[model samples]
Structure formats: structure tokens, C-alpha cells
Target: MGIKAFLSEPLARYIVAQQHEWIAASREVQEKWRTGLVQKAMNTQFGKDHFFKDIHSYVDFKSAVPVSDYEDLKGYISKIKEGEENILWPGKPLYFAKTSGTTSGTKYIPISKDSISNHINSARNAILTYIAETGKAQFLDNKLIFLSGSPVLTETGGVLTGRLSGISNHHVPAYLRANQLPSYETNCIEDWETKLDKIIDETIDQPMSLISGIPPWVQMYFDRIIARTGKKIKDVFPEFSLFIYGGVNFEPYRAKLFESIGKPIDSIELYPASEGFFAYQDSQDEEGLLLLLDTGIFYEFIPTENFFDENPKRLSIGEVEIGKNYAMIINNNAGLWGYSLGDTIRFVSTNPYRVLVTGRIKHFISAFGEHVIGEEIEKALRYGMERHPEVEVVEFTVAPMVAPEQGGLPYHEWLVEFATLPNNMEQFVQDVDRRLTELNVYYDDLIKGSILRQLVLKPLRKNSFIDYMRASGKLGGQNKVPRLSNDRKIADELTKINQ
Candidate 1:
């Protein structure tokens, strides 16, 4: 084995051993974090206002702090922006993770010195966990490419501000930094296409062992690799053994991505955000990402059905059950109190507390009383594609078609971009609809009641979604096309772009 691989093995084993301890004591670890975080923030303005000192139990914590979105914390965030100290956490945040908001315009999420470790170390531990479990650490010996936003950052309210990926770039350990590609100069380019081109130029001839990015963007990279060299990625990077991805479901992009690579590679999925690094795939044998209980964050779950209710029941780690969808809430060391993450997840295993990201709370199609979620649609499409091995999906989005221009019944419109169109389009549609019906009984009821027609599949022109994203100036960097929408805003734009 090479020097890098030889050294990483022992460290990997130690990390996994430590992780197992926390995983085994999941509930206790969470309780500890909850109590500790509350104590740490007790002197802060938000803590005083929320009566943090009186939070002796989970019930008290819930009563003291209401579940909050970004808007709810904007006041404190605004103060922090203007150089306020000890407003939320113990003191001023190390940085602000700037993200484009839907209703709030631009949001600045604070990253405390204590909390940044979770973001950086959780990622490291994930790799270590993989190395420990699979006994495959040789990837450390070669080049590793992380397709990410520019590391260039600007200041906001005296704090450095940038996308989470860009902020993460600054924290990458010197050891990995030595093997990381494309060069720092290439990573600083603003335009995604130009940066991607530069990345290709820098790494096309290198000994790449791992590629990490959001799936769609990585797919773009693989496509570019193929186009430039007229060879599959595996041919170009024979040692490439791992693909680490997050931000979107991989199933939809899996087939096309593997086709581009000409072979399959092990992959790790991460549940990370501007708020915190939540979970990471810990084992190759496991079906779900292992939820991080000791990560300076306390987690809560509200049944997805009760998410919009006036007083939804919030359950702690010990109270949650497997297989039920819940909207995730977090109270973290970063000073976010009862923060609603806007994402929904289902626990797949309770023994060690592993979860599958089900969908987003707002990214669902509940039009016509048929609540269809991202997971269902992605699963249904995958089910159909499994039957028709010829079909290769590039990208897809579903939106409610409340009214059809041709005067037919309103239906769910699926705008799909196919890399290779199915020979039997009609059969493929029927299979997808069938799977969706089986997965969502409400949708099946709508179809049976004639309240909605069977979903209409609209084939999109090449790079239709890419064009739409580029037009909106959201071509890359953690931006994801919503899988399901209740309205026609994205649908209409996609149609126009396809035209």
C-alpha cells in the first residue's frame, strides 16, 4: 500500500470506533447535546428571551422555543450582521453561510466556531468510516476532485460570507489539500461552465481516484469528460473508485451517470446544509445514512402530516418510530433554536438511528387532494426504468397542470429530459403511473375518481433543465430543481425553455 493509504487506515479505524460509541448511545448523546447547547447559549439574548435556563426537559425546551424558520430568526441574524455579539450563540459567529432565499431574498446563517467543526469533521469521519468498514483506503493515494462553488468569499456585516461549499473549501485539511484538484485558481472561477472547463483541463490527465459533488453537476462534469476525450470517465480515470454526492436524490441521475462513467463506483450520500452536517452514509451494507447524534445538534421530529397543524407533536430521538415521515427540527450549538430545516425524513432504522431523506416540506404536489412526494415520484420513475432497461433519464420535474390548454382534464405534468428515449413510451408511462398509484393511494383515488387524469409525460429537449437553470442564473453550486411542485411556476418556465 502507498504511504497515504497506510497512514489513513489506522486513523479510519479510530474514527469509526468513536462513531460506534455515539451511535450505540444515540438518545443519550442527543440529550447531552441538547442540555449542553442550551447551557452554552443561556447568556445570549435569544436564550434569555426563550427562558433557556428553565429548559429542564424536552417538554420545557419545546414550550420555551417555538419551531422557527429563517424568517423567525432574521431579527437576531440582522443584529449579528451589524456586529452584535452574544446575540444568539456565546459570541460572534465565525462566518455567515449566505444562501438565496425564496421569500426572504438573501439569508445569512451563522456558523459558530464550535459548530464549524461538525461541518468539517463529519465529512472526514464519513470517509474514515467508509475506509474502516470496507478496508478500502487506497483512494487517498491519488487525486480527489471536489466540484464546488468558488472559494472566493465576500464580507457581510464584518463576517466572511459565501456558499457553504465555498466556506468548506477554506477548512479542507492541509493533508487533503495536497491531493485536492482542480487547482485553487481553477476553483475560484465564478461561472460554473468556465470553471468546469478549467477543472477538466487541470484533472483530465491526473490520476483521479475520487470525484465529489452534487449529482447533477457531477453528471455535467462526466459529460464534459466524455465530450472532450471521447472516452468514458473510467477509461480516463482508471483508479476512480468513489463518488461522494449530496443535495439531490441519486437514483434519478444514477443510470445516466454510470453510463457516462462506463462503470459503477461506490458512492456516499451526505445530508448537509447551511445549518449543519446532519448525516452521512456510514456503511456500505446499510440502507440509510447514519444520523449524527453527537454532532453538537439536537434533533426533533414532527409527523409530516402534523407539520402544518397549530400544535404539532414534536418527538425526540427516543420517541420516534421507523417508516414514518417527519419534518425535521433542529436546535444546534450554532444558536439556532427549534429551527425547522424544511426537509422531511423517514427513519429506516432505529437501532442505530439511520434515516432516508423523504422529501422537502414545501416541495410536494398536493394539488387536487393528491399528495405526491419527491420520494414517490423518484421511486416510481426508478421502478418503471427498471422494467425498461433502455430508458435513460437525464432530468425530470413534476408540476400540477390545473388547466390544460387543449381542454382536457387537469393532470400532473412530468417534464422529463431523456438521454435515450424509451422505445415503448406508452408502456413506460403506464408503468410509472402504476407504481406512483401503488405508492400514493391518494393519487390513486384521484385517478379513480376522475378528479385528475393520468400524469402526462412531456419529453423535454436536450439540456432543457440546464437552460432553465442558466437562464435563472442558478446553473450550479447546490441548486436543485424541485422534484414536485403544486404550482406551475417552474413548470411554465420549463415549458417555455423547452420550446
Candidate 2:
């Protein structure tokens, strides 16, 4: 791959031009955005009931619309699916993104034309922003691969339902599709194994520069490419430079990816889901994603400590303090008003704000007083992995062992599937357990007080999580192993395979 200077310069300039006023005066921009969005949709059903016209300020908006979730807005969503008009948005959505449901069953999120435009723009801006920051347009010369779901859209109840990545695939311009690897036919393959095999067959010899997808699946793609070619990823794609990942933290996969690629390249993180494109890593100097304040979505933060409260205090962007975990709430052009996305984030910066995704609200283990999250588990795993450089954890998940049936004392149970197993299991156990003790005070106290035993480690059988997801019909595209669970559901399921 060589210079694609002409290709990126115009778009890069356009992005910067659009961002200029917003980046300079984010607070002012945000205030204006809220007003415009509220006023424009004031006649919609939700707006009428919530008194959107009366919401002249953030305080008024907060007072009018309470923090909500899928259940709170399901009535409006149901009407939308039935082709109703002026329910949440002004009219029916162009599509319904069937979420890879958490603990709850399937959720159908509306994707209106306006909302989808916003999603596309935000994602576009992220890549352009990086191009502007790094001044490396050569990477754009080659194909940009999105190891996403199929491009085929499925219609249901007068609205389409599909994975977000697949939905995105449908929107790729015909011109760009020439540069986008993995042809339409390969991407549409229903079974992940077959699809992955096809992707390898199609893109292995192609000039790939940028790769974007959720971390685990992308890793799987890389593994296959490497195994078949018998070469490092860097050699496989000589110009490969950027790997854009979202839906999960990249820290856990960092070491293994580096090992596979044989060298480091620029890695960008995105926070995109069916609901919205929330944030992207604006600067690789700092690891956190810069909050996309001027995107179509208006954000609110509920302190994680009070996240389960019937009425948790919600804080505006300005009101959010640094280093505090908050469950994210949003009011967006999509008609998701005061809706919590069920993800938690911790702020790292306020000026030109940036934040780290800490965990999922539904995916955590707090069997006793010790509340452990994905962030802690990642940190613990990173610590262990760093110590044991020879070993590589391909994937892992944790669940609470809360009863005497499993063991005498209740403790966290980790199921790790190794790419390269640790030479010593005892060393692996000590490394992860020691890190968790250092990272979480409550966990340390529980272990010290004998209220909880040291965390247990279990090696998962090969392809265990993959097999599980496949059986559950969630094998690919944004479906991931829940890093931590409140109960032993995932633990029991995986344990059966090992047995």
C-alpha cells in the first residue's frame, strides 16, 4: 500500500470543518443541539407527553423525562414495529436493530433515517478524525475491512431487524464496496464458521489496510488468516496499519493481537452499539474515547453506586465528575429519551472530554459486598498476562460461585480459553488473583476477612464460548462472552462442555 493522499484529504478537511465550531465550544454546541432536537420532535407522542416544548433547559429536560430503559419505552417501540407514526419519532423507523440481548430476551431498537444518518456520520467522523490527527493517508490506499455481519436486511412486522454491522454494510456505497474486502456473498453466510472460512478465502490475498470489528471475532479472522498462510499478520497485509475495535475492551486482546501481528500498529477504539455511536478514541496518546458531545445523542450519567435505585440522580455532562463510574443515559434524534444504554463508563478527562468503558450494568459479579466489573477483570487479566508473556488468553469470562455446591466458600470463578496456555497453572492463578486483590479494595477485604475465598481459575475446553454462542444462535457479529456474571448461568453452561 502506498499514498492515497488524494482520497482522504477532502473528507478529512470536511470533517475538521464540521467539527471546528463544536470542538471549540462543546458546551454551547451541546446546549443548542438539545434545544434543536427537542423542538423539532416536540409534536411526537413522547415529546407531547413529556412536555418537550417546556424543556427550555437541561434541568427542565431531566425533570420532564425520567431515566429509562428498553422496558420503559417498549410500548412506543411495539407501536413503531407495527408501522405506527409519531410514536417515538415522527414516523416509522427504516429498520429495527435486534439486539444480542443481555440477560433480557431480544430487544428491537428503532433506527430512523435521521438516527441512522447520525450513526453513519459519527462513524465516518471517527475514521476521518484519526486521519487528520495522524496525517497518514497511505493506509487509505488499500481496502478497509469491516469483519461485520451480513449486508442482507431482514424485514419483520413492517420493520427490518438485523445486526448493526450488517445494517452498516447495506449502506456502503457501491464505489467503496470495491475497496471493502469480504464480498457481499461471503458476509451473508449464516453460520459464523462458514462465513469466517469464506472471509479468509476472499480477503487473504487482498491488499488490506484497515480492519474494524469487535475484538474477538477479528482475532478469530486473524488466526485463520495466519494459520492458513503460515505468516505473521504484518506479512499477510504488508500495509496493515489500523485496527479499529468496538463492543468490547481491547486490553484483554492486546498481547495476543501484538503476538499475532508481530509488530505494533495504530489501534483505535470505538463505542458503537445499536442505540448510537457514542465515542471514539480521538488521540492514541490517551487510551480513552473522547466523548462525542455534538453527535445527535444528548448524554446523561447516573452514578453506578446508585444505578439500581428506583430514582438514581442523573448528572449532565458538565455535572459528571472524573473517575466516577456512571451508567450512561441518552436523549437522541432516534427518540431514545433519557434511555440508559446499560453500559457504564468512567471519565478520564473533562476538557474535550474522554472516558473509559468500565463494564456492562447487567454483567457484573457482586454475590457478596464485593462488586467486580469488566474493567477490574481486564486489569487483573492484563496483570497476569504481562507476568506470563509465554501464555496468551484467547478469551475469558467470570461468574459468581455463590454456594457450597461448587466449593465451601463463595468466590469468583474465571473460565479462560487460552491461545497459548500458561506453563504453570499455579503461576497463572496467583498472577490473576494477586492483581484483583490490588485493584479492588472490597475484594481484598473479602478475601482477607475470610468472607470469600481466593478466586478460582478453570481452563475452558477449546472453542467452548464459540460453541455456546453458536448453539444459542449468537455466534458472530457483536455477540461476546459476558466477562462477569451475577450468577452461575454461564459458568454452568461452559462447565458442562468441560465435563
Best-fitting candidate, scored by lDDT: 1
Alpha-carbon TM-score of each model against the true structure? 0.99, 0.96
lDDT of 1: 0.92
Per residue, candidate 2 scores C-alpha lDDT tens digits across 62-131 of 7899888898898888878777888888777888887856545788888888889767877777888888
Q: Which residue runs of candidate 2 sit more than 4 Å off their true CA positions?
A: 1-4
Q: What are the RMSDs of all candidates, in order?
A: 0.8, 1.8
Best by TM-score: 1
Determine which window of 10 residues in candidate 1 has minimal summed lDDT: 16-25
lDDT (0-100) at residue 387 of candidate 1? 95
Tens-digit lDDT track for model 1 on 277-309? 999999888899999999899999999999999
